[model samples]
Target chain A: MKEQILKNLSNYLELLQERFGHEKIWEELLISVAEYGDSDIYHNSIKESLEKILEVMKIDEVLCALDIITDKIEGFPKEDLLKYIIYIKNEYCLEKENNLREVKEALTELATPIIRIWHDIVLTPLIGTLDSERAQAMAEKLLLFIDANKAKYVILDVTGVPYIDTVVGGFLMEMIKAVRFLGADVVITGIKPDIAHTLVKLGVDFNNIIVKRDLETALKYVINLIEKR
Target chain B: MQERVVPIIKIYDCLVVPIQIELDDTTVEKIQKQILSEIENNDVKGVIIDVSMVDIIDSYISYTLSETATMARMMGCYTVLCGIQPQVALTLAQMGVNIKGIYYAMNLENALEILAGIEE
Candidate 1:
């Protein structure tokens, strides 16, 4: 069983290399096999392979590798398989999240859509700690959802968010810009006092995003804004 | 599945219930059973659901909390949620789970004050 599993992994690697190109396969496919293949291969083999690939790989290469592994092994229990995938995904998320620092410097380069008004979609919620990358992702996702649904307004509620920094503050402003580009009004709600103080200390301007104390107020504002428009 | 220790204490005629767990379905069921019996047994005028220890609050848990508040109100008991984690509160808010009618406080002591006010 052990030898067969190694053979199968090598064979699968060969196929992956042929189909996806060696660099793509090497970066992406290697992690999945090492993680989920029959419980025969030595852990050392997995670690050594990972270490060699990681040493020279770019951030994108590592992210691609994680994505591939997550796609392939998501079905298995995290205890059994997905743990490694999650570890890589978290690393990828953190890496990309950190990459947003570069984006903050090039804030003018950010292409935020015009806020459009859609009467159909009821509410839009923004969850997760809004780092620049996650904020950008959320902004883009919100725009897409608004445009696709012709949503009249979106509620950007951040009450569940634990903390925010200067980068995240800028990201929120960028999100407001993006939402505006989609012709949708975005109501920013759930601003806890600590985050509000952080925004003030960071010297970030939220003049454009409509502010509300909480979701109920945001929802009420959304309803009124939609009604008036 | 760690057992949560909730002490039922009387503070100026109101029942102060300090909850120490995530407000998920499992915890909600346990709480519902516990609080209902406690409310019936004590005939308290107010209840404080302390959530300082809860880390996560999805829509399901929010709905349960909201329902609990409603039921408490129907039974003539005021309910308040205390020490809600900011992250959990944010998620619940975005998910459109409004604990609108229920009182919210920063800590168990503050919640007790709010409940005590209602009791008096």
Candidate 2:
């Protein structure tokens, strides 16, 4: 994409210079606009490159270029400039959205981190609150991991979690059930007092799950279970 | 007259099924029958169906499999499904199949391990 942009750079800059009658032109600005204005996106880096333009070029020349493009100048080719602005604006919006989506994906992965703490055991330390989307994402990851690793036990640590409602409790149960289907036992540890109270009040059953007081107890219990088996 | 869809090899008391062909509704139904009969004939304690080579398993096919596992459970035989492709698993999970009455494993070895555990 960058190579393609470079190939068309001369023609595009020549056209702009001919239309605006600006003898001194900024090649980097045009390239940056074309480059960052395409599929690739690092919003801050693009903005920083734009800021770097102020250090090297005269501010008035840049302003004049902007004004002409924005249709402030008399007898400016109105249609083509409008089309260019529309295209750049649309591309900028799309690039920003892509950037946001990437951040969201990374955040989801970071939020529900699953660590293989030992042989036949994986530990997922739950952080923050749970929503349906986040819960489903976590469930998919956990289920696949269980199947791939042929895991024997999973310790879910929720000590960092602030609260758990009935909805959250349901999500946890569903995740546990999916893991069970994959033939791996799940041991959820580190339930806070508030979460425990919420769980009890909600009348959630603990028959299917093995819960321990802390991470240490959970690991010891799993080791013992493994040994006996 | 229908023929057998996949070979069912016996390893210890467990029947290992590697289903490599594409499964139409009829094929899966036949496979189900084959597995059930093998359970009775061999006194099979467990069945492991490997679907790694199969590319796709639609809703009907999955339903047939679930039913077969249920039937096997009633016959005092455990069913463990192994090596389901990632895409198929995603589709099944989205279809909201609980995959009840059946277990899952990573591969043949793991499936055998699960069956051995159940024996204990």
Candidate 3:
């Protein structure tokens, strides 16, 4: 009976390995969160990525599952970990995969019946991690959006962002540059104190990217710029 | 039946092709050739390409895209690159690829509006 139990454990280990191929744990967690309500393509990738993370971390199966599932949820219940097992398993088995591709699709998903709001004024709201990949995508989208809309002013609100590194900071500068090139003024908002300190420490110059304390102030600033123009 | 031949949506009377993958030399060439042919065969005023599907575009691809837009304009067809991912835009900016004079839109719908306004 002990040997049989060991044999079953080995089989389970193999299954876990197969699920996560090569992705990191954090990526798996993030991807899982994103893919929670998506299709099979996304669903499988998240599972596989998570599985790989679990194996690489060499975490206990039960504990690993608990952690990943909790991370996947926006607001995980702060109850006993055991009590959450069923919920975790349900989410793990049923949730879809959320990958970079899905995010891209989501960004452009606003294509139908296009918002023809006056380009004479524009607002490009940015949210989440301002990593290089996401920054570039946002820059391109905003520039094109601004040019297409012929907006005189573009407002970039980063209130939802947790942090900004050099690469991302540089991307913000790029957006300002592109917006100005298209004859539009840019107003930046949501300058968190920590983010400000990080930027200063990086020795990066935000001398040009117009910044404001919050979205409300930035909105007012943008309105002033547009009116003047 | 075979997959339906997607209708060529008209934007500024130009054929706006929505790309569904990363932009590489080969894909850009394929798109360029398609645009050239469409320009010659149809009264395409411009091309608005949606590249949000593209996660990464190397400098070479960026160059080609810029060149293609210029070529389209020279051929009497304006080009608009729409729905570029924000991150991609940042990279392009760092690399100093001036995608100027090339109309850009946040999405296909926005692209269409830009093209339509220009058409009017």
Candidate 4:
């Protein structure tokens, strides 16, 4: 079975090289061999020879070549070869999905850190898009940190947040109130004019909350409050 | 059962009423009447409603509180609400009930400080 497969593959390789160029044909052949090789010493040797023939190839080209080979190979169990291709495609897709999920989790942790900048003062600098899940996670994290640290003041720097919708606006209000309940005042900084407009249009009242133009002003105000105390 | 009465404590020239019980319609009305009467009797300059122990505040109660604050203001008393739980504030904001012109302090001490500042 292995000998028949290899003989058909090599014959098709030469036919592909004649129709396409030698350079393109060899690269696609190498990738196909690498993707569909069986776990046998003989198949491993076949793959090694194909690898030496090509430097690099696009995955789409290799998949295309596989489709052509499965069709052209006469009397060989085309079903078996197609199964191997399907298995390889599924594995690749799963690996890509896993990598994407890992990146998202890393970004979430990176964006929502609660840092204690001074005694009785903590700063939470939010960056990236504010979605409902991210907003809820931030609220839980900031509230827990304030209660645990006994922080008197929290400076919420939203310079990196691009915009706010009604859902996020409501969650932000909830977070501010939670901080106040824990006996710590929240100072919001770095609200862009556009965001301010959105909040107003959403009918969000910021009359009770303290807002600052920038982090510098917020820090100065916190320091003065501490000094006065 | 005997009718529940809200206590009004007089601190200096301010009438401090810490709402330790949950407020229903009758309780809120009774408290409002008591607060107005106390303001008139003591001639106090400020009224502090400490809501630290009260967990839930509905729209009706919120409206009542605002009305009571307005009434107190008319009778020459500054009404300050202190110790409103964070959850209550969030609920009120979500409910779209604006407690406008009513002052809030973090605690009773801060409420007293605000009243003192106003006195000065």
Best by TM-score: 2
Report the CAPRI category for model 2.
Answer: incorrect
Please provide, for model 1 over A1-229, each residue's C-alpha lDDT reduced to its tens digit, 9 standing for 90 to 100: 3344344565545644654445543634345454545574435444444554555665465556455544554332224333454455577789887788777534423322233333543354544455666665555555555545655467766777777887787667655544443334567788888888888887755665688998787777777755763
Better of 1 and 2 by TM-score: 2
Per-residue lDDT over A17-79 for candidate 2, one digit per residue giving the tens place of the 0 to 100 score: 775544233465555555565543444444544455444456565456666543522333334
For B1-120, candidate 2 gives per-residue lDDT tens digits of 336779989998889999988788878989999988888888778999998787887878878888999999989999999877654665565556666678887678878988998843
Query: Residue A18 error for model 3, in Å?
Result: 65
Clash pairs, candidate 4, are: none
Colliding pairs, model 2 = none
Residue-level error in angstroms, candidate 4, position A202? 3.7
Q: Which stretches of candidate 3 lie over 4 Å from their true place?
A: A1-153, A156-172, A178-229, B1-8
Error of 1 at B33 (Å): 2.1
lDDT of 3 at A53: 54
Model 3: lDDT of residue A169: 79
Better structure of 1 and 4 per lDDT: 4
Off by over 4 Å in 4: A1-110, A115-122, A140-154, A173-186, A193-197, A200-211, A225-229, B1-4
Give the 10-residue window scoring lowest on summed lDDT in candidate 3 chain B.
Answer: B1-10
- lDDT of all predictions: 0.60, 0.75, 0.61, 0.75
- lDDT string, candidate 1, B3-115, tens digits: 43466677765777777654567868677667767777776788887776877777677778778878877778888877665445445533445464578665566566556
DockQ scores for all predicted structures: 0.01, 0.22, 0.14, 0.12
Q: Mind sharing the TM-score for model 3?
A: 0.42
TM-score of 2: 0.67
